[model samples]
Target: MSQSLMVAFDVPDKKAALKLAEELGGGQGKTAKVGMELYYKEGAAVVQDLQEQGFAIFLDLKLFDIPNTVQKAMLQLARLGVDFVTVHAMGGKKMLQAAKRGLEQGALESGLPAPKLLAVTELTSISEAILKDEQNCRLNLKEQVEQLALLAKAAGCDGVVCSALEVADLHQVVGDDFFYLVPGIRMANDQVGDQVRVATPAKAKAWGASAIVVGRPINQSTDVKTAYQAYLADWQGSEQEK
Candidate 1:
């Protein structure tokens, strides 16, 4: 599978999201992640609009619910012809399987390829202290993430959404067939923000991330295009000898 640097369109509405997408790619086909902030506000219409402009969509709702409910929701999302979708891996194997089944069925009906189903292992925002104190988990952060990744793979997920810090270890344990899509990407000079486990784009690339999702570093920059190009350069190892 090809690697991608997905631009997260974390804007609040369709107009802003579309405007940014047009500015970035101008219908030349770049992957754009539509997270809950935009999706909840604009619904599927925004996805359609982006696709109409030749941008591939990564619908990152991170669905977590009962098996049947998640399955039904996946069915609907599949029809949107998104390139990827996410679910919380903590939901367990049955729910993941149901989601996969729903996507398959929905895609078949819609005559489009099923979007890649990626399981969210642990948010980059969660620290080990939070995991132990608030979530009451026995395993260390890495252990918990590994277990979730195993469950997701067994349940037929295409890959996982995890921190870049975990990708190297996960590759050793989970093998390379399953892709690792890392988020919480920051450039060296960028503020860490709310993400506790952030990594630079070059680090994510070195650690073997199949894809990287970036938002603020690109979207919040005064020079949006230049910022994206810099991130892409790091991701592709264009700035250094490969």
Candidate 2:
């Protein structure tokens, strides 16, 4: 796998997402994640077209349902040739196992590489205060991330979607081979939006995150391509900073 970022296309519709994907590919990279809204409007056609154009697609639906329902959905998602997909870690061990089993069965039936399944541990919108005050917890932000990550791993998940803050410690905890797809990444001067745990692109890279999931910073930019370049440059600068 290349050390590339997966920019998310959270467009209002699939048409916008397709156009955005083309703009981002202004050849800097060849892949993007298609999230819920776009996928709903365009259906699997969005995934098929991008894959045809050589974009490594992350079908970021963040699937969460019963084990059987999720398994069935995974089987359908498999046929579309997406490079990666997301499931919720809150679903627990048995459900995660069912997802794994579902994916394997799908691969055996389809005869293709299975999409890498990533567990979404918690939403980036959540804060330490929210966790402690709202969720009734005592652990700090980093500790909570670790706990959920461990749960996902013990349940046979391939990777987890974590916020930038804990990726370094998690890389140490979960090992390099276990994937970490981090989001809530805002630039040094960017607005944090609804997200509470964001880091700059450089910080995410130093944390040993396998990939960064950036949205509004790039999507809402006056020039999406320029924003993307800044992110790439920030990531490239991470090594020197370290």
Candidate 3:
């Protein structure tokens, strides 16, 4: 796990998020994502309670609406004090700009730290065929990533959400500090589930990932705490060896 290895709690409700957070301590105890499922159930109060308990939130709405709509929605999400949020790079420049502006304005108004705005280049589930046939993106994987990485940077996003596989190439195109929030990470021996281009923590770091997202390999293990601690030990060991 990287510094931003926010374990996705893809659980069904806020109660589940809180329970899972409690069960898994450390940052897992302090940070978790609230995607569509839980967000719809508990709303901002869930965010408040978690933050009140010293947790950091990543409001995983992946907002992709029109400029005005995304802006308004981001403003509200910011007011809730979520640590991070994302918008689709495909949402167009105006929408991305609006989203960034909305977060900035919300921070200004509420006297709260603004959430980092990440541009989702593509979902981890997407494949080469989908890139070519469905999205009509002409570039191959590397080219497409570079293109989107540039787009995210130019649109004022703090970073791009990519798979660990794209990190090195994207870093080359965008530079070291442009955050890459990678998902679709599988441990060296873990099941891949639905993610196509996953990599291990060492590989992800070698590829220049700023952080990564890990789900079942840690969360769904028979011994969740031990599994997560193994990941921590492995990743930290690798970092220290460097």
Candidate 4:
């Protein structure tokens, strides 16, 4: 597979998402991310629509239920022909294993490529302060992320949705081939918004991220196409430097 830069289509509904998808044209090297809000509103039809439009769907539902429930849900999502899907590593090894099994089964049944199962370590919106104080954790941010990533790997997950700040550490521990999908990517001049562990695109690529999930910097930009192209340039330039 080619190196991807996923534009998060985290809009309100299917109509809005399709509008953006039309403008961006998921051709080039771009991929589309469908998160909770839009997926809940539009469901499988939205997935089908995007696939038909030539976009590889990165379904970001972050499944975090019991083993049986998560397995069943992944089984269904697998049939959608999504290119990527997320599950929370906090759900433990059994749940991740169950999810992997379900995804494999679904792919086998449908005779389709199984979506890469990415395990969520921690939300980029979360801070070290929040992890220590709010979440009541002893481990620091990097340690916690590393631990979760190990568990995800042990359970046969293909990759992790980690903060850009933690991607290097994860890469060191997990090595290459275990995907590192970093989120919380923002342009250097852009405001951070709700994200706490943000990094610029160049920084993310330098840290060896497999892919970066970018949202508002492109979506909310005044010149969406130019902004999107600028991000693509950053990633390409970074790769060439490597």
Best by lDDT: 1
> How do all the candidates rank in terms of lDDT, highest first?
1, 4, 2, 3
What TM-scores do the predictions have? 0.96, 0.91, 0.92, 0.95
Model 3 segments more than 4 A misplaced: 1-3, 26-30, 238-242
RMSD (Å) of each candidate, 1 decimal = 2.1, 2.8, 2.4, 2.1
Q: Higher-TM-score candidate among 1 and 3?
A: 1
lDDT, each prediction: 0.91, 0.81, 0.79, 0.88
Of the candidates numbered 1 and 2, which has the greater lDDT value? 1
Better-scoring candidate (lDDT), 1 or 3: 1
Candidate 2 lDDT over 1-242, as tens digits, reads 22357778788776677677777753234458889888888888877777766778888998888899888888888877777888998788778878877887787788888888899987998888888999887888778778888988998888999988888889788777898998998888999889888898788888787888888888888888778778877877744311
lDDT of 1 by residue, 1-242 (tens): 12288899999898898778766755454788999999999999999998888878899999999999999999999999998999999998999999999999999999999999999999999999999999999999999999999999999999999999999999999989998999999988889999999999889989989999999988877777788888888887745322
TM-score of 2: 0.91
> Cα deviation of 61 in candidate 1 (Å)?
0.4
Please report, as a residue range, the 10-residue window in candidate 1 with the lowest summed lDDT.
233-242
